[model samples]
Target: MGENIDVVVIGGGYAGVMAANRLTRRDDVAVTVVNPRSVFVPRLRLHQLVGETHDAVVDYETVLAEGVRLVLDSATGIDAATRRVKLAEGGDIGYDYLVYATGSGSPSPRVPGAAEFGYPVATLEAARRLRSVLCDTPVSAPVTVVGAGPTGIETASELAERGRAVTLVCGGALGPYLHPRARRTARKYLARLGVSVIEGSDTTVTSVKRDAVELGDGRTVASQVTIWAAGFSVSGLAERSGLRADAAGRLLTDETLTSVDDERIVAAGDAAAPSDLPFRMGAYIAGCLGAHAADTVLSRIAGDEPAPVDLSFPAMCVSFGRRTAIFQLARKNDVAVPFYFTGAAGRKLKEFSCESSVEHLVNEARKPGSHHWPKAGKHRPVVLAAQRGESAAPAARDT
Candidate 1:
């Protein structure tokens, strides 16, 4: 056989790891995952980490295939012309195909004093640091959580359940992704858990102080600790490396997940912007993107055209402490439906979703290409129409 196809995946998170394991399906491909850490961070449990309820770390040995190499280092840049990835620690590694899955981080807050006074709990290290500080804080101290996304809700609920006074500051609607009915149910559950839900256009933190958080409306909430979980931002490595990237620094790719600037470079997860539109950042979509990237490489090696990605969101889960949760069912377009799962049933489903995410990776390692998700209704018709050389409406861009 000729030289083996060297595939270098940058990142050890869900997407990168899944891509690495799935690449093992072909003996001609050798996968190397270069990440800043050796252990996998179960991002879904980051809130539990702050509550000291879960460690949220997984050994790579249990999730990676035997032939995949793990490089505990960060990618500084990529020389696509030479197929070489620059490493932060030192030298460079050459590859025949590159999977850009650097993922994302908790976005830097724009409010004054937020960076210096607020704590972020997006990664394992950050979560551990937040947990340590919480341990030192008095149990009765008022803690404020800014941002009403899933992370913000989960963090506030977790802290309230642990006896810390938590106030969820929603700059807008709480759980905007949830339908009005589902959101009402969630708010009630959080209220029962002793969490204060503040929702308003002017509720955003204008400034964060060591002892309090100032809102846009000039109201101040007494706080001993401030947790920020507003949004996420991808690294600028792709843009810096001269690759085509969107405004957020996510690598731009075609529908097949192949880089628009470089065909050999495939992107997945939050860092991938396909056709100027990116999928929402979540474990389910990330896994689907990762697996699709792998399939693209294998198809190329077999001299066949790669298929475009087809994915959908079945539901969204949010935990309001250990006992109460809400699973918001979605339509094909990802619009939350009025019907939903809540209470103990929702909690069980949330737990299952978290656990099964890990299981999906491990099972993929044992049997590549075993992981599969249903395609959204909108995507299926478009794809089929394209195959038949017929024009179709564009897929919905909303998450």
Candidate 2:
């Protein structure tokens, strides 16, 4: 056998798993996936965990390729100069190529008393804890869900369907990325499920209490339980390791997904900012970037220039309980249009998208480069500029 290329992927989220699987396309590349957990957390169904409707986890044996090695450990640091990753348990992995895919998690809330009083739903343990709390709490308890993004909306609606009193407090507009029609559809379904949708500038949570939550506008919402789905925050390993990263700790990379400061290191999923513009955090985008990141490594191995990532959002789906949902069609640039599917049709589509994401990962595990996605035409300029080593263009804040 020829000399093997060691590719170490940090994180076992959708991106890491997909990257590990796809890296098997190369016969000379040995892939190792490092994660703290043994099982893959299906974050899409975490709300179902809170509702006790589904188990939001799957064994890595079912998702990861046979050629991939699963290391149950966390990456504590990275030494880009040495091409080695430090593990929390105590060893270092030397890699010819490294993939940073450590996904995001619920941030420690800055709001007064929030961290002490609220529950976050970004990981397996968090969801399991929240599910236990929900199961123990009385059905008639007042539950306040802070944030109106997909996680918050889905959690609130799913609980409401279970007969819990849920109030969805939006710090801003509900589903701000959704088109007006899609937003309307979401609101209708939420209202039908008896979820109180609180919006406007005053809806921001200022403080959390034992039995209530205080709003910025001096209003108090009665609640026996509070679920904090406000937003996700990535790991600080990149920033701490002196890797060039954005303010949110996402490693800054070129359009080809290669770290701007280090050609030997690439990044994927929510941890990667390509051309200074990170894609919206979701399973769909994560799976795509995972494949692209692997491709970049393969390109380097083959002595060819890695192609810039080509990606587009065909649609974004939001579930409003198990019975209803909203699938908002998007342009290539990911702007939600008026066209959408709602009710049961939307629900089915949402379900399929979730299922297909895992299926895509499994297929890639078995078939290597079996995954593919549409290209965004508008991203051409950005890609060209990145390849030319030009300055980064300003990015709009969407997700």
Where does candidate 1 have its weakest 10-residue lDDT segment?
Answer: 390-399
Q: Give the alpha carbon lDDT tens digit for every residue of 317-395 in model 2.
A: 9998888889989988788989999888998999999899899999999999999999886565565558667754422
Alpha carbon lDDT of each predicted model: 0.89, 0.91
* Per-residue accuracy of model 1 over 220-244 as CA lDDT, tens digit each: 9998999988988899999899998
Q: Count of backbone clashes for each model?
A: 0, 0
**What lDDT, from 0 to 1, does candidate 1 have?**
0.89
Using all chains and alpha carbons, the TM-scores for the candidates as numbered come to 0.95, 0.95
